[model samples]
Target: MKKSILTFSLAVSLLACSYAQNIVDGNKIPVAGNVKISLPQGFTTAIVAENLGKPRHLTINPDGSMYVKLARAVDSKGVLYLKDTNADGKYEVIKGFGNYGGTGIYTKNGYLYTSSNQEVFRYKLNANNEVADTEHPEKIITGLKMGRQHETKSIVIDNNDNIYVNIGAYSNSCQQEDRKPGSLGVPGCPLLDSAGGIWQFKANKLNQSYGQGTRYATGLRNVVGLDWNNTTNSLFVMQHGRDQLNTLFPDLFDAKTNAELPAECMYELKKGDNAGWPFAYYDPFQKKNMLAPEYGGDGKKAADASYINPVVAFPAHLAPNGLLFYTGSQFPEKYRNGAFIAFHGSWNRAPEKQEGFFVAFVPFKNGKPSGNWEFFANGFAGSDNITSASQAVYRPCGLAQGPDGSIYVTDDKKGTIFKISYNGK
Candidate 1:
């Protein structure tokens, strides 16, 4: 027992030393405004890969290799594998495969799973955790409902061999006339019957459909960012709130109120949980869930008691595209078991300056948020006040943690992979 303890101590010491060495040797990359990603005092960032394609969701293997899913196919390939041939902390070897395109990619249980808009597929990995057969991935789930709005499939897998898939609602608020001004919300929101929720399926099952799985939660407008919290044994998701509040109900909301009325919410979910998307939205100022205007709400009415509330409510219009729970040791002690979210920036907050083009950190303890959320990384928008989406330089879309506890954020605009590391203070 003493010998075993001594060996474990030595291995941890060696790993700590190696981690420090990598930080000292890694190149510091500059981002927007010539600023180096404005991290907390002790951390630094580097660009490991750049200018590939429209990289969306990302997953880092235990061996430090990365698999990135693309929003659009590059040269007919939708997935890219990146590896650092040398120990220089730069991914030099790039390979692409899988002809389909979507926003979900994950590595788990000897398989690398990816999702198209309508299906989930997995490629078995080899002994090295690399894809064994990229050309022939097993279709795990198929025939998911798809539409024009929020069609990307975001996915998360739990330790219990269950996969959670997000099926976003196509309409803004399940209106009688979609996106039409002054249109009333359809009572009982029929869209929630099949979309606007998370569905669970067997991770290894082949060719499964909607009828084969169970609805895990409902009433979310869209969930591009979600993760299974291994520490709490629960699922957490970020919901994109309904849009065009002021335009749809001008008498109830002004432009400024529209910009900040609905709060982007993070919810710790369970079976049969409802967030009241078309009927209610979180009002950060009121600190309560407000009734949505389409449901006869005049902007001041609070929601009923049946809907679940968010654990964290962020500024309205910050499109949270990715979320991750920090289980890494390289960050400070406050970060462990906390959540990291990537805000893809807003396109609709026009009369007001755009917000949330950065990464946010929410500290949690014992399955609940213990501290105030703060920004961990910023300056991805390249400008402080964004009036248009095209004016932004890079939009952060995904987050992943490396085996050595480093954090990676992927930019969907330029396909840049930014690696962030911490050097002890």
Candidate 2:
């Protein structure tokens, strides 16, 4: 019996060694040092978290735990929690707080901060990354303009501990009345004064109030995907471009050109960066930026000096909802510095057959885009015919990399968190 036990131990050790060797070798799978990554065969997705009430975004703690943000429509009272009860790469419910609102949640310097349509707040977190006490939520800023159009609130922090909140303009394109073209923009566009930009505030201070050393940047329409790029040590965002092309202007843009034109933009934002929204869009097909229809362009010429070109542009109406730069070493070397974008799919590309319902990968070298992106993962649509929105089972809205190097993708439409890992067996 003792001999049999010793053999079992030896077998276990050998198995562990095999896994280690596989991981070391898997790091070299992408031979070209490009964006192409081959997934290991027999790999399956597991649910590491669930029932997260329209989970919108997620961030990882240093210790492999995650803090997720949920949309207000599902739970009007506040957010929910999931703690890894067994430490087996999954989280179990531990605690929750807040009232129903479209706010972003993130952890920095032992504090968990959240933002609502009108205010930004923070709370103290325990060692486990869970809310230790919600006795009160420290209001960081207030008086942020909120409206129906582009109202989903999002927040992020920089290495300097400066908190940034996105206040989206209520109007579609700052039209004279809102969504109407050829109409003069409101002088100075009051929305620019209170919304349509990133507002900076002191993250460590409480009740310090709004409009104090705030106003870090301006001229952003609706930046839902915002993060501090560790590679460049700067803030980056993906903007959902203006919609209803051609229909809003037929003489300038036709159906096919409008469908594949205006590229969804990814910006490396800095102080005083103005990406033309109501004025222009980056046209990927023409391979040159073009002026927005509202400002009057024949869709052939580009307004060079008016707006900054995107570092990366994708197919229009793809609705890039989430962006993450992989810094973890769990994946292959080629993917170590690349960016992952979750496109919530196209709605306006109808009749031409909707597109962009999958996650895409953009290769990055030394903090800049190396080349055009490619579809990294497919089969999310779960069907061949996407005639209507109801037929889609998954619409990826959030992305997070686990401590173990597994990728977590959240489907807002179905409230599912898919954990993708390598097996290499």
Candidate 3:
């Protein structure tokens, strides 16, 4: 027994020595004294901003300035700010305004667009990236719908300058009462009328009304992360899949499969693209699209052809909260025109393990995924263990690429912003 114990101790010591050398050589970032993982060479991480109150989304202007949106507060509604105080490629919070809460923020032709629960609004930005016209808080669109299930109002714009907003459904899996499984859906799901899809409106028009414009897409549970792909000239959205299969329907999904089965999806969306939600979810384990328990699909079979397959599918509950296509020359040539997704990590995979607290990269060739995805960054959980949800320090919820080719990630949990830049050493 003494010999065996001594042998194990010696092996561990050697491993620790090798890990320390790797960190000293700048080959990896040490998560702890004994463990480290590789990052891109000469790429350094720095905190650009901290102590924000749930900074959800970010956008960059024609100049080097940035605009950020905050969500929910006890006293104030929310604030949108312009940050360019230092001119060092970091936001210093120069000025801010807005009394309403919103997530989606974009600037086009001097107008800054944002959304509240049931409406979309705009403000004019000046030469310094500050709100120049506060009185022109035009309510562009109003009175769509809002509820607890998918209340985040994510908005985007296309090259032609049309505006799009993802108004999400108000239930989990179309349950009779939010997340309770096997509860039959409402006869036609009244929430479908005003919610559960993307709506399009004129970007320059004011006082635009909802329920009067065209439904761009339907059957989307919630599309929080959306961006217009310039190469394909199409919009892509990353969806948050539903949860708790076996706990709600033990007759169908086994506990292990339930924990790690469904494929969080990325879709190449055009007008009228119908992604299956509530009725189905993609099962990565089975390597096929499977019907949801509420819809009567067994664990291994794909649903009917009425539902569209995802262009790319990721592991369950990664919570892909942001998507951006890299359009800069600062990084290596391999990363241009690729997609970066900010995974907010998992919460429902409890007692099994959590996943996806890091950013991932998927290279694109001719507007499609050219290869398998890779973990571009890690260590956001603050530890390797993911057994509990609250232990995570930084959950990546948003992404933005600056004009100088640096990438920024925002964490909603701690409200921190990290700027990643290549040092070109």
TM-score of each: 0.92, 0.85, 0.88
Q: Write one digit per residue (lDDT tens) for candidate 3, span 52-154.
A: 7788888877576777778764246365465657667456766566777778878778788888777888887777666777655888888868887678888
- State residue 114's C-alpha deviation in candidate 1, in Å: 0.3
lDDT of 2 by residue, 1-425 (tens): 33443453344335323422222112222211232222344334565776667778776666766666777644344666666778786687566667756547778898888777777788888877777776577888777777887887788888888988887878766777676545545655666877777778888877755567466667677888777888898888888877766677655555555555567888888877777666667776455667665666656558658566788877777788888788777666667778888877777765556665566777899899896676565445554457665567777788878777878777777676767676655
| Predicted structure 2: clash tally | 5
Which structure is stronger by TM-score: 1 or 3?
1
Q: List pairs with backbone clashes in candidate 2.
A: 76-100, 77-99, 77-100, 78-98, 83-92
Clashes of 3: 0
Q: After superposition, how far is residue 419 of candidate 1 from its true place, in Å?
A: 0.3
**Model 1: how far is 101 from its true place, Å?**
0.8
Candidate order by TM-score, decreasing, is 1, 3, 2
Candidate 3 backbone collisions, by pair? none
Cα lDDT computed for each candidate against the true fold? 0.85, 0.69, 0.75
- Indicate the residue-level lDDT of 143 in model 1: 96
Give the winner by lDDT: 1 or 2: 1
The per-candidate count of clashes, in order, stands at 0, 5, 0
| Residue-level error in angstroms, candidate 1, position 39 | 0.8
Residue 18 of model 1: what lDDT? 44
**Shift of residue 155 alpha carbon in model 1, Å:** 0.7
